[model samples]
Target: MYCVQCEQSNKGGCAVKVGSCGKTAPVADMQDVLLRIMQGVSAYASLAAQKGARDAEVDAFTPHAWFTTLTNVNFDADRFTALIAQALDMRAKAKACAVAAGADLSDLPEPATWNPGTTASELAAAAPFAAIQRFMDRDGPSIVGLRNLVLYGLKGTAAYAEHARVLGHEEAAVSAEFHRIAAFLATDPTDVSALLAQSLAIGALNLKVMELLDAANTTRFGHPEVTMVRMTPVQGKAILVSGHDMGDLEVILRQTAGLGINVYTHGELLPANAYPGLKRYSHLVGNYGGAWQDQQRDFDAFPGAIIMTSNCLINPEIKSYADRLFTTGPVGWGGIPHLTGHDFRPAIARALELEGFTQDAPEQRIPAGFARNTVMGVADTLLDLIGKGEVKNLFLIGGCDGARPGRNYFHDLALATPKDSLVLTLGCGKFRFNREDMGDIQGIPRVLDMGQCNDAFSAIQVAVAVAGALGCGVNDLPLHYAISWFEQKATAVLLTMLHLGIKKIHLGPTLPQFLTPEVLGVLVDEFDIRPTGDVADDLARMLKAA
Candidate 1:
């Protein structure tokens, strides 16, 4: 068992005994098995989709399955053990569709040919047969790394696509592209040039995924308005919603409308408070806690039920509150209660039963949801300020946050930015410095929170708009990127940034472990991707790049 997919990978040793993210060796191996078998399913699904055969269940399940294996999404060995059987069923359905279209099945890999046992114990044994580590030959780390890079990007796209799908939005093109890349990886293509092309194609696909999510969120709830959200907990029966899913949060808000429960946004969901449709609710309160990494203590102190709607879930520290830890959609832990439908009675009931804060916490608030429309609404005024030399540069400093010492660099970087320079942030990484006051540049806020990581579309939209007004390409604008990455979702965001011709991105807490020196060298040469050094040095370096 070996796993080093995230930024917090081991220094001198392999994670054969246990993953740095608290995943057991057996669970890590099973996740690999799940990913390998997914490629097998995709091999058939890709061919079937080509023949004008489409299955909504199969299309949606592909993303759902991929997202489950992401770090911290699911650590229950039994869940993967159960998912393997479901994979066999999906594979059989996809195979039948391919056979009906007379697609060639003979060249399919062993994963496509091998069938898992029906019993749980037998299924557990068969997972080892699908391990991905067997294909890592050191001779071609660049090739293997690029292939896996595409796979990781696909995983991130799957998560974004699933978020959109849950909101009753499904794009066949997104699903088809995902299956296409998964199947291509199964063939083990080793050509460096071709693999590089496929990797960028995944980036293009991610762009579409983010667009769909943007439409889904904005269309369902009105375009996010720039609003201030109170940080202090309101005195009442409270429930905190975290992660990136706006769909579930809407449903939960509706279900608990008149139940005397005050819903508070936490982590990435902090942006939800800016949506007019969401903020209209009477019981909808302010945000609580910091980012996903700090959930152990945050979730412990909160005296109410917790709803983890998506990824960035940590195992709860409070044993008593663990009962209140509820999982929904793609997120799941071993013993947590999961909500299958929009009905969140258990979470609501728990909130009613638990004793919320006896008194109102101190008054504090933060700004969020500077989504494209809201940012652009005031774009003319901001543009005037930029033209007058009041607004100098724009810095985007946000992505996944990790439990590492170097992460504090993000916190300090925000503080070091000149008041004349506007700072834009999204994703959980903003938690490091979000609470600190950067104040406002003129009437515009100095630091803008642009929603979740999936809302990279908003950042892209703002960049394109700025470039259009300035009569230059996005790369030619005064904007510089210091994006942090922890998982595949961040990988997809990086690929999209590169695809848009944006360069000189400083990525840290640490670089991905999957990239070999050769692969890392290729990115450094082609895209100018650099690992972040000292906060002051990196900030000066990025400012100089503009």
Candidate 2:
């Protein structure tokens, strides 16, 4: 099995023997089969939609299928078996409908019917390991790379779409586009122009999905507010919830309330402190660690159960603590138990079983609780400061944080920002500058935390408001976007910026492996996108450009 959908691909290429993320050959093969089944399901769903069938049914299945195929979301063979079976069944049903309507179709075998029995040897023997091999043999590297890129991007979009679905905001068009791309991936390799159009369409549809999620989060949680959160460990039996899903965090917080189990935000969940609805939970403790990359070390020390809600899950090395790790909502791996059907009771019970610390450790505090609503509440004051020239410039510097050494660029750039400027950050990337004593300017915090990666929506909202108040387009505002992206959500956000014509944004530590030179050219020409260099030089260039 060959896998190259993430940063840690074996030797910076495909993971042929075992996944860099700790997936075995059989699991990787099953994942590939699951992906093929999903594509088949998408093809059938797209055809159904075109033929005037019910769109909601198609929408319900589209995003979760893509979400399940994301980098580290699902490794559980049982879960994957069920999902593949469901997709193949859907495909078969759609084919039957098409036939009744007098349409002839290729008779493809159903993917779900292939059963991988419980035993490792039996599962390996039963799974379709050869199918993916044949497909890869038939496809060129460029075609395979593009398909992987689009598939990964869809995974990211599906994650956000699923989050929004939990909050009751549905966009049928976004779902349709996902199905469209999935269907496209199944077809024979197309011309470059057609593929390019489909690639851009992924970007376009992603914007709608992000918007829907942004709306769902802000509307349900109340706009995030600028508030300080302690990093100190509180005394009690507690559970750590990581990844980007606030809905899951909220539910976990609610369920753990009377159970004597405290809940602490980890990774992307660090931003949950900004939301009024989530923050009001008395038992909701502060953030415990930095980014997703540090989890192996961080999780080792923490005695409580850890629940991963989304991407960037690196498999743990300690096999003894396997039962202590719980995952839900698009995050999974082989041998790890996942919370199914939105039921987190198992996670809470595990937290209780492990018990927590008997006493609180010395408390440490860091400012959190900055999101779009929080920023906008003080917008008038910010505008007034800008009008009087008290605030010189604004820097929107945040994105995914990784193990890369160059990520120090964010800290250096934040440090280099003039004292008169305000720095806005979100996601784990903020950990770089969040610890810095940036100080306040006229009662407004110099460094504003805008929640998780999806909360880049909050940053966009603040940018638009600030620009409107300053009587200029968003590009004309004294703001620059220097973002570090690790996954597909970042891809979707960058596309949204392009869709809105926001220009002169800087991205790093390196560009996506999936971006063709020609596609990169389109971004450079259309959005004035550039890669990050020396922080001092970049700052000078951005100021000069402004």
Candidate 3:
């Protein structure tokens, strides 16, 4: 199997008997088939749309299904098998509807025509396209890599949209762009120029997806405000909610509300403490972990039920926390019982049975929830400090966290930033040094977190506003972006940054494996994207700009 979509690329030939992400050959092959099936769905769905026969189910599945194929998301072979079958049925229905509405279907590719057989064995042999490497090799690296950028970026966009969809918010524009792009990838276009345009188009569309998610999150739970979340343990029967899903947290919180179970936010869910609607529940305690990569130790030590609501679920091989693990939403595992339709009773029961912390641990707190609204509220103070020559610069550092090394560079850079600069952070990357006492620049805290990766939207808003107030473009302002990415959400956020013409982005711990030299060149030439160097060097370079 060959998969070079993340930073763990092996010269774009990442062929292994087993994937580095722990996907076996059979599972990787099925995943390819699954993606191909969606291409077929895209083809038929596009045709169906011309006939005004759009399917909301398939539209929603566009992102939901794509997100499952992301790195470290879904590895259950059986789940992929079931998903492929359902995809075939969905494509057939879409095709039937489009044709009945007088739409032509003759131009669709083999993905739209091939039949994935009834079982897993048949699927491995029945894949219609050549191996991913071979097919991508037919075109130069630039063409293939550019197309992949759009594919991964759109996958990220869809994941964000899916989160909003669960909260009863759906944007038709996002669905249309996802279908259009999926079909575009299905054709395997060789024109790098066209692919570049499509990449930017996906970026523009992602901006909308981010905006929609912002509205969904803020409207549902209220805009995140300044809140101090405890970093230590609170003694009680506990449930740790992780991932980027608020709806999942809300449901389980509602179930365990009157009960003695205390729900502590973990990983990306830490921002839940800032929302008035969620914080209204008195039992929703504090945060307990750092990044998703550190969860094995945290979960192992935790004494209550653990909920895997979304991506970054623990590998059954590396650690066996699945015994006490319960999953919901799009994330799942082979042995873990997934909560269906918000029925979290089993998880709650498991939480009650487990003995939590014996007593309150030492109290330590870290501040967060400084979202767009919160930052904007303090804009006058921040800008006034800036004008007074006290707050000299702004350093925006954040993105996904991974087990990959060099992430300590993030820790060093944050610690190295001058006290006069405002250090804004988002995503799980902040866990590197978020608890550090950076103190405050004037009255503004040195490390102002804008919530999760989804809150990158808030960071963008603050950037634009800061630029506008300074009478310059974002790239022209005394602001910079140093981002570390692990998955597609970071990809989508990068695209949005490019869409806004933000430049000189310092990205690390590694560049995407899918980016061939040619594709990386385009980013360097057009966007001035650079990889991080030594912590002192990058820190000095960031200061040099100031």
lDDT for each of the candidates? 0.84, 0.75, 0.82
- List the candidates' TM-scores in order: 0.96, 0.89, 0.96
Task: Assess candidate 1 and give its TM-score to the true structure.
Answer: 0.96
lDDT of 3: 0.82
Candidate 2 TM-score, true structure as reference: 0.89
Q: Which pairs of residues collide in candidate 1?
A: none
Q: What is residue 176's positional error in candidate 2, in angstroms?
A: 2.0
lDDT of 3 by residue, 1-546 (tens): 777766543322474676555667777777788888888898888887767778777877777787787776777888888888888888888788678778887788767887778586688786535246556546776676777788788778878888888888886656767788878888887887888887888788888888888999989999887999888888889888888788888888899988998898899888888998898888898898888878889888788888888787766545656677887877866766777899989888988898888799999988988999999998999889888989888999989988777889888888888888888999999999899999997667899989888888898899889889988888777786789977788898888888878888999888887878878888899999989989788777877876
Q: Clashes per prediction?
A: 0, 7, 0
* Full-model lDDT, candidate 1: 0.84
Model 2 C-alpha lDDT per residue in residues 1-546, reported as the tens digit of each score: 666666566734568788767776767776676676667677666666566553465467667766776665667777766776666666667655555554435643343233444345554565554243344556655555556556676777777888788788986566667777777867644465666566667777877777788889878988767667878788888798888788888888877888888888888788788788998998897889888888887787787888998776877656445678888877777667778777888878888888577778888787777776777877888888988899989998998777766889999999999999999997789988788898999988899887778767677777888788778999988888899977667766766677678889899887776655666776688788898999889999988876
lDDT of 1 at 429: 90
